[model samples]
Target: MTAAPALAPAALRVRGVTKSFGDLAVLRGVDLEVARGSILALLGSNGAGKTTLVRILATLLAADAGTAEVDGHDVAAEAPQVRESLSLTGQFAAVDEVLTGRENLILVARLRHLPRPAAVADAMLERFALTAAGRRRAGTYSGGMRRRLDIAMSLVGDPPVIVLDEPTTGLDPQSRLEVWRTIRELATGGTTVLLTTQHLDEAEQLADRIAILHEGRIVHTGTLAELRALLPAAPVEMVQKQPSLEDVFLALIGHDGPPATAPSGPTAQETAS
Candidate 1:
């Protein structure tokens, strides 16, 4: 019998991975894959082990069983290789506060052993819209500016894959939107982005595919539209001159439906019909 053709290397592949902390199991036979240049958003409620899964992929934590590959490098055996091929941007900005934005970038470039560190730093400062503030201490920069610098630092080596854990947590609305745009551009430029976020809207906007984890296991995983299809559409509240039942409901209850719009909630008559 002829052997099956070899499968193409995935940007990231986690197979039956399990992790435990004493009596608690953080990851239970979890399996996931992210294709090259695509965005995968891992969503979960608190304590669902989203961060644990990310840590495992980033080689910051070991799994009790199974294996994972990042950019064709085994996460457990080839951890250094996996670390070299991937970048991790955590919830807090990791840039050096005492260093100027340019200095921070240069430091990272030097660590990555990029030729002409100053030139690379200059280019990155421009790319991240930080040229004006490149000479200023990162400690003095605004939240958005600091976050941008942190992300820019992560790009010093131009790694193929980036794992972001809540890259936009405390930023204002406009700043959050800006970060979203940056993520889009990165994916467009052939970077595989795997991020974890609590923002449903962010996932809806940025994720090519989303996996919702519940209790350390994947409860839902699909394109946003597919996930939406699984859940009924909520009521459409309209502003009109005449009052209707929906209007009365809104006036009395202050919402057309529950404040938390869940996928399994009842569908609006208009949408259900």
Candidate 2:
């Protein structure tokens, strides 16, 4: 008898993916994979091509060369299937300010052709802790509320993969923590999440695996401890105390010391950077 086949594809896969704009090359032969129900964080400074790579995977921008797949569907050739498998939340909230939080989710559900759109909307509001604010117009919602509503709307399609590009930007400490909890819950619910963020602490807090993008290529990829091993030994003076997450991050990225902390709560979960 033939051997049993594997049941599911890698949640995401990319091979030598490249993108360019005239003389400027944004992605250079990028390769990575993410398993189902896990979180992979893509870390980079501004212009490191994190967003460009995400756009290619999301089918918002076509790659100039190489290939990508979402749940085994080729992003370029099977664009519709790729889109059907993934939901993208960009840096800015994408909900309609004029609509109530509930209405916003219902509209998204209806657009996705889900039956019982109102029911789906209500469920999402409750899941995101927006049930109490469901009736308020989104225009009057705080930044955090709008962000939560935006993410809830993304789930209306119930895709298997979620792509978040700087999803926590501009959120207050409590709001950031709330978003972090929501992200963790998504992974716990068996959804694959690919996140791009500049916050090193955020990546350390939540990523199962982390990839660093620099100069249009993936410079390194591994679990936090593995990445830390790539760094040179700290000076004896600096080693008098146990190194912090920021130390590992700075060491790997070749920075001198920790950057200024954002006005945020403690790291949501601890892991080596």
**In model 1, which runs have C-alpha deviations exceeding 4 angstroms?**
1-8, 232-273
- lDDT (C-alpha, whole model) for all candidates: 0.85, 0.87
lDDT per residue for candidate 2 within 1-273, as digits (tens), equals: 999987777899999999889999999999989999999999999999999999999999999889899998999899999989999999999999998999999889888999999999999989988899999999999887888888888888789999999999998655676688789999999999999999998998889999999989999999988998898765432212344565466567665433324345443533333
* Candidate 1 worst ten-residue window by lDDT: 256-265
- Model 1 per-residue lDDT tens digits across residues 1-273: 999998768899988888899999888888898989999999988899999999999999999998999999999999989989999999999989999999999899888888999999999999888899999999999887888888888888899999989999898644565677789889999999998999887887788999988887887789988987997667655333344553465457554332222233333333332
Alpha-carbon runs more than 4 Å astray in model 2: 1-8, 235-273
- Residue 82 in model 2: lDDT: 91
Q: Model 2's lDDT to the true fold?
A: 0.87
Please report the candidate that would top TM-score against the real structure. 2
